[model samples]
Target: MALGGGTFTTMNKILPGTYINFVSAPRASAALSDRGIAAMPAEFDWGPEGAVFAVESGEFEKRSLELFGYPYTHEKLKGLRDLFRNIRKGYFYRLNTGGEPAKNDFATALHPGTRGNSLRIVIEAAEASTEETPVYDVSTWMDDTRIDLQTVKTAAQLHDNAFVRFQAEATLAATAGANLTGGTDGTAGDAAYQTFLDQIEPYTFHALGCLSDKPAVKALFTAFTKRMRDESGVKFQTVLHRYGQADYEGVISVENGLTGAADDTSAVWWTTGAQAGCAVNKSLTNRVYDGEFEIDTQYTQAQLEEGIQSGGFLLHRVGDETRVLTDINTFVSATEERSSDFGSNQTIRVLDQIGNDIAALFNTKYNGQVPNDAAGRVSLWNDIVRHHQQLQTLRAIQTFEPENVTVEAGDTKKAVVVTDRVTPVNAMEQLYMVCVVA
Candidate 1:
């Protein structure tokens, strides 16, 4: 007889020690997660162009130089500065996804742009303490300050860094500095913006900003936003400047705002960050534009009314300050019964949260583990009830009757059907007061 029992492929054979797979509870999805991730494309000095670059809050200034090789206040970084200003207050992170690098004689800039021309490389010899060969200090300098330093005896030993790549067949010799020249920015076209979209498709952000005023570019963004929200199951809104379409609930078109000296579309920067930073349970109506751009509110009352009627995201002057009149997106329904329900961004937030949370719960925990029987269906229903109850507690929705939520087995034993409804709560945007004197 064999020392150990072996598995048999015979007729009624069974051999098993243990078969177990661990599963995590769906509690992680219940937490109120981070908010305000805004994505956009811009001209940058360094970093990978046509790829997503994540800049977390408070890291923009330092990371900009480290990655883009330029400061926020650089003359060529005006647009980036505008974006960082609004993002500083609201968004937790911003994703930059455009800009090509400029190549020079000695080394190429980390990113594509004329800013690369400002970079200079300095090679010096680091003194040796002992009786050994001296290590050369190869430093990458943007202007005066050294950003990266590598110690190498020969040019062949130099490795590529975030700032620049070492030139091949280069001799290691002490030189004052070799300034990079002929670096140029890539022409920004809709194709460049499309590259950004493609790179950011897998990312999750609250709002996407479209800086370009081109009709074709705006159309592409609108189509992308709609497809992502409706078909791809990704829920997020987009902010565009002066877009006239009000048929989609996922797009917020900025009608009028202050045009800074640098660019007229500077408002796109702040608006995108602010809309993205708005909490899921709150509305942005009447919120103050605390950004750096001076809004252009030189509009008549008639224009204001027309702008609102035409589904424009308008800002207006109020008591020596500019405030958002309505935090509405372009989502006016065609039917009278629908009314202006979808027009309010707050409503959309609630609905989006519900859809996202429920889908996450199903996909993460109950996808294929639970049986498709009565008990399993009840478990799913219980989870759904708990989730909606939590949303109700958050004041995101109201009028939730437990009886309205029902989960039943579908025609197929492997499927289950869920039917539930809840009234989404919106912030009080209007009031009717009657004054009476005794």
Candidate 2:
């Protein structure tokens, strides 16, 4: 728990899921929430990298014993405990099954959606005999608030009217902002100011999940700055974004002893294909609507646990695209950055082309913002009704035509018309949204 000094400590004792146990700098317990880690001495041994190094030797006893619970666990845990010595044997089998080379099979994609988290952990196995075949079970505990960033009905000012566009970028930014106290680089203890700047890493989930297997995903995402060597070395990079999703939030990186870009061929391929399904809430590929990175290893022996169970997601799907008109009249005049309001038949540059679809499901809270024309009213009204049915829906059109919206000099506060037509195209502009789940 860090305050202004360089000192850090963990809550010395606790059981699983105990809220009070955590580690940080002096008075740094609050930082745990943003980082999504519980550093209770019961589950973790806290200190700087080398600070804990001496404990392994006889030089200093560890301040405490701490273990991390990765929202999931292996099945037959109780039964497996009896054979705890067998974990090493089972792990070797898993090692041989590392699949393909990370560079080949691994995949990574930066999603534009902002509702998600990150995850990573070591997966030591339970002891088992070849006859019984020990299994690894997993469970999940997702935050109910993961889906709380609802369709905003009304906000006096907006950076952009097009909400769906750049969602992934914005989400990443928020995660970064939340995880910081101030700076980015540090050793054990810098000045009081330096320590504060260094601890803000976990809460900013700017970078999404490692999203791939040990052999590949970690190679792509760990924090390192690039460096040059006479022997031909690449630059080192530092971990940039923060993550705090589910119980598995912290610096997402590769596990030790695991080859990142291994010389092996299969390991590379496995990294790009299907990651060990290790993501926390949903598949990195957007396969399920609302998913949980839940593992039910406790029931591994049941044989019926193949199906993964998860909570709901605000899945986005493409809607009908035939109704799209290349021509659209800008309706609202915006003073905010990144958005535009075109007046009448003027054309707007379509910059928002990235999305799962082409139509919009709008919020009725914006009903007042629609233009007064007939067509504008219709589009606005229809979108509102559709959004009420499903809060987070898919949208076909994301980027609006960028145009210069000019209203008569005195119409500053008034809702100026952007369409070229004198009559309204649809009046319910504020009521509708473009991105809703189908």
Over 1-438, each residue of candidate 1 has an lDDT whose tens digit, in order, gives 324344444545344443344567545344444456788776544556545667776776766677556666666555556566545432221223344455545577666666677788888878752237767888888887778888777778888877787777776667888887776554555577777788788887778888777888889999999999989888888888888673678898887755444336678887888777777778878988776667888779999888877778888888888888888888766477566788778888877877777777787767888888888887788878887887788888898877778999898877789999988888887899999989
Off by over 4 Å in 1: 1-29, 73-106, 129-135, 260-263
lDDT of each: 0.74, 0.20
How well is each residue in 1-438 modelled by candidate 2, as lDDT tens digits? 422323235654333443333565422111111111111000011122211111111111121111111112323122112112111111000101111111101111111111112211111232331334433211111122121132221121112211111122221111111211111112221122122223322221111222223333233233221111112122111111111111111122211111243321221111111121212111222232121122111222122111111111111222311111111221233346423332211111111111001122222323365555555544543433332222112222222222222222124443433321111121122345589788
TM-score of 1: 0.84
Cα miss at 246, model 1 (Å)? Answer: 4.0
Models 1 onward score TM values of 0.84, 0.16
Best prediction by lDDT: 1
- Residue 278 of model 2 has an lDDT of 16
